[model samples]
Target: MYNPNELLTRFRKYLQAEQLAKSTVEQYCCMTKYFLNYHKCGADRISTSQIISYLVTISSPVSRKQARAAIAKLYFMLGNHQKMNKVPAHVGFYAG
Candidate 1:
């Protein structure tokens, strides 16, 4: 498994390569790090269900949306298109 710091660095590069706004990149990276720490596992070991569960824990709608987008982007960076597709589309809906 790749080191979490290395993975986060690559993820930052990936977001930059996509030309995302500076704040968006920062927010995504921050949220991704929180998710990684919360799970205490490598990015590859994170399941879609785990992602949803984490998002659900965020009580604020905006924060939950941001977290969902962040995790989706992380999965995209990891080349896990299937898992990316499984992420919830909106903060109001749960991935059931």
Candidate 2:
């Protein structure tokens, strides 16, 4: 049961722990915020399927690559899925 705030806080920590650039962390957080909002702010109750579906929807509404990268990070956080396998290579995940 990972609360959204807790999730985000940990995301922030992960960014720092992973040594991601500060700007990258900010961008990832912003992307995640939009994602969280799109999912109705489900907190710790959001499911993987819902997250994947949401990623598909937002991919068109927003930057498809960014959407994919965000989802990949989420998968990493959730620890239940493969990053590259779940995210398409064309999503610009490897761009940055």
Candidate 3:
């Protein structure tokens, strides 16, 4: 699992490395931070239930899609070294 700071740092590197647009990077960064704080858990200790809750907070499918894309971005980071994807367990399972 990624800690909040690590997530931010990695996203920063991804933004620069991938040459993502600033606004796009900012949105992903914000989503990453929101997930970190939403769980009330440490960056390293965030749990599946908390992740589900955060996904549930999305009001629309389009919004959820964007959120999932953000997660996939982090997943790429998590998976760089043959690591597992970082997307939470509730991905594609959240009903709302």
lDDT of 3 at 30: 77
Each candidate's number of clashing pairs is 0, 1, 1
How high is the lDDT of residue 56 in model 1?
57
Cα-lDDT of candidate 2? 0.60
Residue-level lDDT tens digits of model 2 in 39-79: 54434345445555566564445455665676677767766
lDDT score of residue 54 within candidate 3: 78
Q: How accurate is candidate 1 locally (lDDT)?
A: 0.65
Q: Where is model 3 more than 4 Å wrong at Cα?
A: 42-62, 80-96
Clashes of 3: 1
Question: Could you give me the TM-score of model 2 versus the true structure?
Answer: 0.59
lDDT of each: 0.65, 0.60, 0.58
Highest TM-score against the true fold, candidate: 1
What CA root-mean-square deviation does each model show from the true structure?
Answer: 8.4, 9.2, 7.9
For candidate 1, the TM-score is 0.66
Clash number for candidate 1: 0
